[model samples]
Target: MMRSAALCMALCLAMSMAACQPGPAAPPQSAPTSSVAGPPADSAGGATSPAVTSPEPPAPAAPPALSAEAQAQLDQELVAAAKANNVPLVSELIGRGGNVNAKDAIQDSAFLYAGAEGFNEVLRLTLAAGADVASTNRYGGTALIPASEHGHVETVQILIAAGVPVNHVNNLGWTAMQEAILLNSGGPRQQEVVRLLLAAGADPGIRDPEGRTALQNAERLGFAEIAALLRGHG
Candidate 1:
């Protein structure tokens, strides 16, 4: 009976030792995870930095405005340059904001002076600089009238091509064709000027203040070439 009792005690002690031992270690305790996301990877599997945007460039500044007196001085200088046929100076002045059609005290703008005086270089500059093509002079005539009267053949051509009125009559009731016939010496230049006028749609039948046609004026002035041209056009 004692043997049996000692055997029972040994079995109880073994069970108590097994229960005191730790259970599996508990799984190590995983570290806390962050909520922030990492940068996306490129096709090559390398870390890509965040994209940085560049700022827009500033706009260009506006040109400075000129005062009234300064503008008038610039216009005066341009007129003087045109009158002298100084092409370079005229170009410079025009670039500096000189008004190409600004008239002086005598109603003669740079364009008027250049066209009337046959200053072809200055005339071209003024034209390119936006000269008023239909602007009149002191005599209330277009640039074409004086150009025709002065026997400037090339000048006549230029004015006509620039859209000057072909039949524009001056305050004196004279057309370009009439002035070319009455005021000129019936020369080759005058004859050519008449031809250009007729070709550009100048009406030879338009009467003057004296109630005479361009043909009659040519006939009265004995301009055979001009008379022939007027008759042919009619």
Candidate 2:
């Protein structure tokens, strides 16, 4: 009975020692996580920001519109300026929407008058402003005819280069070549005009209203140099 009592006391002492020992320490706390996302990775595994672009520029503004009366007045002014060899006024009027092919009461357009009168500055302006090359004058002749007749060599060259038909027959049924021979004195300038005309494919055989060829007219007018040029071309 003494031995049994002693064993029970020893077991109760062991249970009391285990309960007195402290429990394991609590687990270590982790840091707080961020809410924001990081930059995205590229195919090469590099971080890339969003692409930036510039705004597009605005288009050019169009010219103002004009009424019929206002436009007609501008065209008339342009024609007068061109006829008077007023280069600055012609350019300004053209910029203001003046028609280069608009005709005056006498059927004289800025282009026609400038070309016929050898006004090269005005002619160039009118040409650039869209002069009608095939348009005729009061005489129903191209600017080249009068230019050739007057021995305006440079004017003739400019007109021809602008695509004036060299063999075009005017109302008088005379080509520029015939007019150069029949009207001019066949001086050095006239000879050069004839040369330019022939080079530009003016037909020497095209007859006038009187049914006379340019070469025949030149021979009759005693234009030896021009006749020689015609014969050489033939």
Candidate 3:
């Protein structure tokens, strides 16, 4: 009886001890949240920053080279040199392959100035360099016609010998023969130019714009010898 009573008392004491102990308390709550500065997230509602771009610099402009057209224009120095009566320069240009027949803006060839100005060497050089003997200026005046008009007897002979068309009537309806008699002073030199043109077979019968033949013009201009020469041919 004593043993059974002792076991029952131990069990009651164990139960009382378990009930008397306190239950575990609830878990502690965390503090309010805070955000830290860091790389932005895609899911965030905030607007994204725009990307920056650097512009490229422009390329440098290049210097231009002389073109063929420009070279041709600059080569017209030959024509200008002729007009300026620069014989040495003209000869130099000719020796350097400058275009002997090169024309100006007005279509005046180098041969015209050389003949008109009585630049004998220039004329010879231009002719030898292949300048057109029969080429006319803008006025329809050949080198021979102007040489005749200017009473340049030597130049007239030179041009005539070079095969310039003698009876070529210009826009003014005048041949070299008529110009030698009518437009020039009735001096001995002018008379000699007329004789040369006549010898070259210049058509003495060709009339001027005024319906006057070279014979009539010579007679009226008081060139008795020139008139007599024309009458002899007629």
Candidate 4:
């Protein structure tokens, strides 16, 4: 009986060792394992699945540098501020070595900026500071062309009084007188301008490259009084 008991104990020991030995893991059951949990089950045994979330990409950033030409244009705006006689700004730019007569890429100088805006105080300061009155723009127009065309009669008068060429032509081949009449600029001052030109010995009959005369322009624009004046009519 004792021998029988010993054999039974040995069998129990062998069974225990066999249980500890790893067997081929049962192919993971179709059921989800602990590492990957499926969605929670609903009350009706239906499961709510987690949505697939994609990470959003970041937005693009601004450019890091301005081109050389852009830098030049910025410099031009500074020069314009000087021409406008923003005295503090002018002093700043000039202090920073800005050119007093710097022409834009299109050949428009700082004086043109002042004249175009009819800033008389700035105009006086610019000219007194040595801004060139005779500088032409890209269109070969002196500052007088714009001054007359835009009805800045006082500015025109100022330029005229300063000896600006009243007969100066632009790229379109129109002189200041023709521009005034064609654009109906110069109001009462226009008549005065005509008188001033005539008195200055400006031939009222001078024709454009298109063979049109200033008198013809005056007539076409229905300024009968002006036409009559030009024609020496009663």
Give each model's whole-structure lDDT: 0.91, 0.91, 0.83, 0.69
TM-score of every candidate relative to the true structure: 0.73, 0.76, 0.68, 0.57
**Ranking under TM-score, best-scoring first?**
2, 1, 3, 4
Residue-level lDDT of model 2, residues 7-90, one tens digit each, is: 999999999999999999999999988898778899999999988898899986655899999989988998889888999999
Clashing pairs in 2: none
Residue pairs clashing, model 3: none
Shift in Å, residue 185, candidate 3: 1.3
* Position 24, candidate 2: lDDT: 100
lDDT of 3 by residue, 51-114 (tens): 7888888885543454777646644888888888888898877665677787888887778888
Q: Candidate 3, which ten residues in sequence have the lowest lDDT sum?
A: 62-71
Could you tell which candidate, 1 or 4, scores higher by lDDT?
1
**RMSD each, Å:** 6.1, 5.4, 19.6, 16.9
Q: For model 4, give the 10-residue run with minimal summed lDDT.
A: 91-100
Residue-level lDDT for 128 in candidate 3:
91
Q: Indicate which candidate wins on TM-score.
A: 2
Compose the digit string of candidate 1's lDDT tens values, residues 1-234.
999999999999999999999888666888988898778889999879998999889886543579999999999998989888999999989888889999999999999999999999999988988888899999999999999999999999999999999899899999898888888799999999989998899988888998999889888878888788877886
Question: Candidates ranked by lDDT, best first?
Answer: 2, 1, 3, 4
lDDT of 2 at 157: 89
Task: Name model 3 segments beyond 4 Å from true.
Answer: 1-67
